[model samples]
Target: MVGILLQPQSSPFPLLFLAAVSPPLLPALGVFSLIIILMAVTIGDRLIVRGMNRFRVWLTPWFKSQPSPWLELSWSLLQWGLRLGLWLLGVIGVLLLPASNPLQRWLLLTFTPVVNRLTSLLVTPLFTLGKATITLTSLFTLIVVSLALLLLSRWLRNWIKQRVLTRLGLDRGNQEAIAGVIGYLFTALGIIIVLQTIGIDLSSLAVLAGVLGIGLGFAFQQLASNFISGLTLLVEQPIKVGDFIEVDGLLGTVEKISIRSTVLRTNDNLCVIVPNNRFLERNVVNWSYANPQSRIHLPIGVAFGSDTVLVTEALLAAARQDARVLSHPAPSVWFKRFGDSAYEFELLVWIDEPKDFEPIKSSLNFLVEQELSYRGIEIPFPQRELRVRHTEELRLLFNQPTSPAPTSPQRPSQPPIPPPQAVQSSFSAPGQFAQDQTLRVLLRKVAYFANCSDAELRVLIERGYQKFFRSGQVIFRANQPGDTFYIILSGSVEVLSEGQWSPNQAETPPLAVSIDPKATFIQVENQVLATLSKGDFFGEISLLTGAPRSATVRAVEDTILFVVDRNALQKLLQEYQELAERIAIELAQRQQVLRELGLLNQEDESNPADKTPLQRIRQRLQTLFSLSDRPGWPGHA
Candidate 1:
């Protein structure tokens, strides 16, 4: 074996030269090279492993924090890159070793080749498999990850804006835009990083870039316009969320503004999608842009004879009752037109929020109706009068009465006339007969007393008293006992009350006082005036309860009254419970009006002061029925 090793082989250089290069020098050089290579491989492997470990650690938090599939895919790609690099280097090192050297050959053959082949085989399959796996992983990740990041960044930005920036007194418009920009920037960064990790080299995509650019230009023209419009909106702030706007004739609340569109929810609960371009181009009435305060104009018409000052005051009072209306600016009513049937007026009131305009308008309408009705101001409808020209022929046709021929209608019997003495007697005792006769005539005209027999009305008339008042007389006081109820008879009269009187007596009467042409002297505190001119009755409430009068009555002019005694009223009520109930309802309505006018201050018996009505009812039920501490009835605590 020694001789065989010693035998010389043919070479280009001398044997001694070969010996000098091959022996100690070659061995030392190889050893040094091997040491360097091993050290490099060891360090490279350690780096790869360390990076993989670190990435795994990083991914753990990312996975837990985000639960996004994209991050997981990125982590997997990093691991693959490190493993691939380490495997390639190991294969190269093994292939470079000399096969003739036993130690080197054995080391290469023992572990190097196996590891190299295993890694080499794994490289292609793993890469292909990894690519497929990551493709699916990233696809799913794109949806979930994008959504998650978008929500997170949006929430964080909004939090910062509302909590930090807004608290710092920053302009809300600028702060919102800034927050949106920051959130979008974060989303873009995340997307770029994710795509890069997945091996999508944006720099190498020249053809794709051109295609994308053209496609974007064609497909996203509106999108780009909306983006620009959004920026314009941020800068201009023509409209904002919570603003009441009328855009393209659609009135609604500006609920949300996005890049491409603005969402408006109308009063009808319909959502309207308005394009940004349209918003910029069309006339947009942003009632709250420059000023959040808006003016509400309510137009009303009252009968011509209605007291203008009283009507104005009632309108103002109604407006004042609504808390939304501003007081300092004050409500104003303008007599706009003298309509044919009614006096037209416009009420202008200012409110703080434009959104409240509709509700305020509705409330004002209700109040106007109630107040006007209370004041006896007639809201008249459109009236048209026809003047008929009667020709001689038409007059003859109306006046002519046909006489029946002898066959069926023979001759009508002549009616006998009363004697001169009877006529004289009837005329001579006019004063004594006037009371009963007037009441009997009135009972026939009054719808409420329509069912009463002539006998009953005659009784009522005899028992009832009568009085007369000059213009401007006190009829009753509020909160006084509900005594005599009144029916108006002859001359016009006014209904007045203490609350209606001005606090400063010189200002004006407060009560809704009206000069009713059909009305006569009104009933005062406890008396019913029966002989009001033609067809009026009073003291009906007294007949029911013998209670004091709830309202005062005054004569606007010289007025006549028929007073019904308390005993007479009670007797009538005792005979008819239904009549009593109807009177009670009427009294309740009157009381409600008095309460609204600040004249009546009676405490509601249904509602206790200590607890809400609902609460009181709940407590009563709990105590009486012994209910457990479970869910109580709705609206109860």
Candidate 2:
């Protein structure tokens, strides 16, 4: 080449100048150009892919519906194939550059032999085994196949866990177990298939396996133990997913169980990992194993002088107040022992949700404290003592003169306690429960419920809510939809409206009163239309007729009212058909009284059909409660 350049014409200035700059760099420069071309092709491929991805949302509208999984996967493979083809095309374009371009011609000449030599090397056999030979291509195939097998196994496991086993009505543990077993089987079979396809003789790998096995056995002994324990957990079905388990004083819900470890989500929302073998080896307390309900014992200590009976009552009251405490089990107080400074007692209560252990225990403690304080039962505190060697020194300290302590101001005297007999007044009937006796007696005063049996009244009491109303608390307001019926058990309530009574009226309210037509229900006047006391009831009119409340009723004092809502009345009317007619009659009487007071329209006089209001109320009750379909209802078939 140098001799030709010495002659005249073959573009000596370009090649000669290039060589003159750096003689050794000339060949290396061609290699660099080749590398630059390959980099450009790779960068362009990525840029094209990015551009296509950016337009994916717009392209999605072109398809009528979403592509299936296989179609989507094929599309992904096609994109990679296109990228590879672009690289090949880039190399070909460089190779096809005309001979006139000196740089392109030099690159072609320099890289062609190198590419051929690499190809020869790839095809050359590294070793021959019986009929099977190993080469670079075969090794590359083996690596690709191994990676493909792993990916396929993972995908199969996920698919079975999510789609197949999930729909088969299996629990999460069973699903995970089945999927994991299938995945292992599939991976093993896949390896065998790949090895056979790549022409690898399994018999020739025995010695290699023995060597690897010798090393792995000692290295992975603990790992093997954990794996076996995990498999045992999956098979034996001890603690499952979502089980509330306590191991070594650490309590949490089981979230995941893998071959190596188990994930436990604690009450504080912390995820902890414990080795699988630890669960098998250690004693585990499963709170939510076969049954989630478990008994919780609360150890309580009261001051020594406190009444044991009163302390028991307070503890029982606290447990009864808590709805989480199971009623059938009936919480009991056990007198455990007489401690040094306190009497030890254990409150044995059963609850249905063991996962709520901490919260339920805390709530019970709060309730116990409140009940003990209410009954003036003192909770015991730990006693601390200090010993001094000199008795004369302690006496001298006590006898020392000190400034007189200023007297602390006393708290205002508490309201006088009501007598126990005051609570068990004429409002109670024979054989009535102590807690709800007054309510049952009050309920009996209502004409419609006079004949209710003990069991029926108990049902009604269970269904209705016993709510407390402080003085000045508005029970219901006029023109509001009347959904609740009230039966006063112990205190009094006044029925009034947003109007002034006529001046000429006597102790009785006048038939007409002056009132603003647009006035809201909150503005009740000083005039009280009626003062209802113990065993008296109100809200029956609206409850029966489905009309808005005619007047507002509020507590005259701190009152306990047995409140039965419209749904309870509806159910009661359906079950006791006779009660509906009696209630209709009661509504008529109330409406008549309203008419006499000029609150209701005066001329309903029944004109001549004096039963109009009663019939209207009955029709409304039937419509509101759908009682016409009830079997024993008179209005129905």
Candidate 3:
């Protein structure tokens, strides 16, 4: 047996002596030694793997750019490479043992045939591509290179999109559209280039590609249409990300535009995926298209006996009180068909921002109800009167003789009408109209002065003077230093802000009107922000802060306004400290609201009680009007 084990090798060394002693023991001992070596290899590989993981963890931060797909790929490759190297070293160490060693001899005898078989297996040709015969090795190399190139291309694409296009000032839609197109082109070109590099001629695959394309076209016709439609939307800008739109009664804002579909975020926070072709084929209402301004209609009703003129005035006042309503297109009241119990009227108003229509309309409804109630107008419910003739009653009446006409009770006498002179005096004076009394009534209706006492109102009536303005006349210009405040007594005036007039107001000079209303006085440059009807007041901020007029005021129709100089307003504020606090609160609230609506330009959104509002008012009064310490003025030092 010893001779038999020694005869297989030329120089037995360690194995020869062991086999010489006991041949049967050599096999078991060789197997035990192989198991021990395998255990060591596994243990070493695990330790090495742990070390590689630690190294990778340390190396990760160097490539810290966001969305780093390449970094991830590189780390994976590093781990795999380290594992492969460690395994290769283990195999080489096993192979490097002395020829006489039992472990080395056992390994050679066990794995040499397997290695030879594997090498031969790898060399065998799997298939041919064009003129190139692909083996396992070449196929693996091709796959690796292709994956690397694809990863590099993806990294390049993202880098260009975020760093390059963003810096070029392209809008989000255009940038995404361009990036998508480039990514598609790069993928297609990369595949073609890679195939050619692998010795596959592109000309040979045209037949197969055409057949596949035709098959895919038939299968994905709608998909192709949607993709094309998405491109069209991006190019035409009919709807964009962040645009509010309504399609098939689904109201939502566009969140994302992809090749085959668009995502919409509804007001309820639900995400809906809509096909791009749906937008192209169906009617889509884009509220933000061209401009954000849109017209809204609010339907109202009043008792039939209510004064129509008074109802119209009340409706206009309700609309004018809301800041969202645009003044350029002054709200109009249209009398619809008289209903059974009430007269229906529709108030048409234009809003600068389309999104505000719902809330503004709701607020207007509330205001209309309050105004109608205050003016003694009733909103009647639907009424119907029915007269029924019962069959039994008719039969009884015909059968029996009627007896109700025998005796009737006497009715009370009606009151006699008063004389014409007494009636005329009761209604109005012949020549002397109570205009002053009317002015006082109008002042009482004004919201800003609503809290004033009757005596305060009397003082205002004594100090105030009425000014009449014709239609299309200018009342005040923007940015002009103002010391007077005015309250509308009748008719309507437009409050035009300076910056929002026209898109090209600065580039294209305003058209020279034949007769400029305020053009004679430094020219009126403004956009109509709101309309103020009777009981609406302006220049109150000027009274409080003594700042320049922030907006221009123009008469929308023949109007009358009672003008009060700065002195009177100062006295009113001085006498009533609570009124000043209320004014501050209202002004701060309005500023906050305007900031939310993007109308006011305030830097910080701190707490409302911060000294900003009051300090600003006092600073403006001191700086603009140069108010010194005085006896009556409380704002003075």
Candidate 4:
């Protein structure tokens, strides 16, 4: 090792005194002074550290707001510099003392060797730049400075991209494009600057250019394609950061577009990295490309004998019932074709947002089914008849009487229209249905049908269907079909009032009603509108107003419900038109009560001055029953 050499200085100890003493005290004194200096330096470092900790607390918020690692390093350097300055001042003060003083002589003796070693140049100079010689130390310093400059340049680039370009109102694609270009340009410039600092001539790199070109041509073909594709995407703006897209059967939202890869976030919250070249080469469907509106067609089929006009009207009503379906465009029902056993139809409707595509389509399909069922229009399946010629072998096989063939179960047929009957007596508790007697009694208990005679009640019983639900069971979700009205017979249910429900929002797990029906309890996430016990009913508003469900209803216990759907009510209302006035009054009173209880919003509040509740109810009933051609009626063909 090349050790630093110091120039000889005068020793403070006298040589004759050392000879007299035999054992020298100067070495021991030097050792003691080193201990004292070390102790002072350690104490000074601790004090400086404590002060810096306090200062950091004060500056934490400022640093956090504009967080950068370099800022923290700068602060640390300042602290150490202050500590070094304090040590230097103390040493100078000791040195300034009188030459004859013992403390000055000791300080000089203890620190002189350390000072000389640090100042010594251990390596020979390599070259000269004007007056300064380029040595190993200078070269190392240059490398460190170059690295620091590169880091600073990167930090600046990111700061400009995030803080300045973001606020310029450019599209996200453009921002990323500009930022990527800047990064490449900065990286190249930094390399050139570093080479220049090292005294390397830029012109000397020309010899390797041909070799590099050949390497890139053979090894980086795909990389080049992706880079060019990325530039094309940025320029064309075919898809933005928030655009919902489907490319090569992968569906997701565009999150980021880099030079080689594009990042996508799926609906299930998974990140996908796709090559940029694939987007340019494959077919990509941007759902929200230029307009957010999109049309949905739900194909349906009904029995051949069903009324065409009625099917069209019912389809339109189902579309109109949904709040998400756009009305200005006007939903349409087209008669598509006639199959062997059924008449094929399609319900065409438009929605405002492409994101609502799946949910709206599902909702429309459900409504259409309910509407068709309510109107007694049968959705038929493909059917075929088998013809067998009675040959001798077939007849012999049939006659040999093996076990009978198992037959496929058939779907239950629509109930026959019932003849009016006497009102049946109220039955006992649930889980026991004696004929349709219990259901008929439950129907009579409902407020809407309290005035119905035995004949009207029998008509309802014929048309209604009975369902049993266990506790904590969700009968239907909020904002689903409201085409069916339910009346509790023996048990109870809870009405959970919620804002307009969006399926994409966080959902509660399905209630665990699989165990003991009476033991299960559901914690309502939304506000509890009301609780309904025996003889109480819900879904009247949806049935009467033809609106989506206003609230979710879950069974509180093992409950039996007599459901009266739209068609049954429409049929009964046509026969007993006088019941309309009473229905309106009852519904209006319930509306007022619901509003007072905060279950209903201001939009659904009654305006008796504009139109009497009775008149409005009559108009709605007429539209529902196809008894009017009013201009504003949605049921009009």
Quote each prediction's TM-score: 0.41, 0.50, 0.49, 0.44
Best by lDDT: 2
Ranking by TM-score: 2, 3, 4, 1
**Off by more than 4 A, model 4:** 1-171, 178-201, 328-330, 391-637
Model 4, 65-130: lDDT tens digits are 344455556555556567667666545443343432564565468878886775565345777654
> Lowest lDDT 10-mer window, candidate 2?
3-12
lDDT for every model? 0.60, 0.71, 0.68, 0.67
- How do the residues 188-242 of candidate 3 rate in per-residue lDDT, one tens digit apiece? 7887787787777787687768888899998999999998998888777798776
Model 2 residue pairs with clashes: 511-597
lDDT by residue for model 1 over 1-637, one digit each (tens)?
3222222132222232233233433453456655566567566656665666665564343221243454445444545555556655654563365632554454466788788876565444222222233344456556666666765665666677767877888755557667766767788898877667666565655666787988898889888888889767755778766678998889998766667888788988898988888888888898877667778889999987876765765586578668888864556777899988999999888898786688889999998887776555778999999877868878899889998756775668887888988776675331222333344556555444566654456445434544577887766555566545555556765444333232333443323444343443332233333223335555454333334555566676787666655555555644543443343334445655435544335555344554433343334333333333334432434
The sequence of per-residue lDDT tens digits that candidate 2 reaches over residues 1-637 is 3222112232222333334224454454455565566567767777656665555455454332354454455445545556657766765654544422565566668888998999999989999755678899999888767666765676688777777887999977677678777887898899888888888788867777888888998999899889888888877868887689999889998887767888898999998999999998999999988878899999999998876655765687688778888865457678899998899999888898888978989999999988776666777688867798999999999999999988999989998877877765645333322433345566777777777765455445544655689998889877788778888767899988654444334443333344444543324355588999867899866676666787878899999876778776766777777777776667667876546444357566537755366665677678887776444333444
- Cα lDDT over the full model 2: 0.71
In candidate 2, position 460 carries an lDDT of 55
Model 1, C-alpha of 435: deviation from truth (Å): 30
Residue 602 in candidate 2, Cα distance off native in Å = 56
Model 4 pairs whose backbones collide: none
